[model samples]
Target: MKISYLLILLSLTLGTPSQIDVSEVRTAYIKASGDEQAVEQLNSKLISVTTTDDKVLVAYKGAVGTMMAKYAKGLKDKKSLFKEGVSLLDYAVTSDSLNVEIRCIRLSVQENAPKITGYKKNIDDDKAFILKNYNSMTDEGAKKFVKGYALRSKVFNDNERQLFQGL
Candidate 1:
């Protein structure tokens, strides 16, 4: 009985998924742009996320994957990582089309993605979506996250940035 209980306890501990804090992910994401270590750490934390997990978490997983591509040494590995990330991001968007946070995440990725990657197609659409729906977001944290990103996004012109002011 002791051995069986120990086995069960070990299995339970090993099988449990790590808990993701969305706020921490958001904060890490902001740091990732300038810090490769932050990107690697966030990617490691999010690597276990699957399609069945929360859509927002899936989106972060995708975002970190894309960021990881920047640190990849080989061109093939970089392209592969980017494509996989974009695929996951697209899946999350499809899963929750109306989620403004997801849209913001995609916009951040697309805006910064190289033009040669052909992943820039959604920039205009996502920008428009974010602009139109940003005010409707009920979560203060979500609003702050979006506003923080928009304030720094190159895609948002001076006039557009004004919309997110005083948030």
Candidate 2:
């Protein structure tokens, strides 16, 4: 009975499940016809992603890049947003291209476009690194960090309200 109890305790102790954060991006729908409310809504959503994690910052920066790229040909003289996006993108990429999801978000932004000057090799390297680290990270907090990055990556669009989805 003592042996059996010890074996059971060992199994129970060793059976702890791996940790991960399940985050969702909240989505809303606004006018694609360039309404102020829609733009405001998108900006609000983007603003909400401001957090402490360096990875989240990088991911949000990528999202900002995508938005600036989309609105570049449309906005009248608001070169500010585009400039901000460029700065953020450069900062994030330089800070750590090993951030896979952030790099992926950057790629989805317009960096992958043929006319753009972005390179795929950087993204590929980041992706590989992220996957390797992700697979190896068993800590709940680290997993949550990765999930948050992923959540931020998918939470934007050319439309204004698309930014608020799944939150």
Q: What's the distance in Å from true for residue 123, model 2?
A: 2.9
How badly does each model clash, as a count of residue pairs? 0, 11
Residue-level lDDT of model 1, residues 1-167, one tens digit each, is 99999998875554423567788888888888968999998887777689999898899889889989999999999999999999999999999989999999999999889888989888889999999999999978778999999999999999999999965
Task: Report the C-alpha displacement of residue 79, candidate 1, in angstroms.
Answer: 1.0
Instruction: Put down candidate 2 lDDT per residue, 104-159, tens digits, no spaces.
Output: 45544433333443433454455445545554555454455444444444332334
List residue ranges in candidate 1 displaced over 4 A. 1-18
Q: After best superposition, candidate 2 residue 136: deviation in angstroms?
A: 2.5
Best model per TM-score: 1
Task: Estimate the lDDT of model 2.
Answer: 0.45
Q: Candidate 2, residue 57: CA error in Å?
A: 3.1
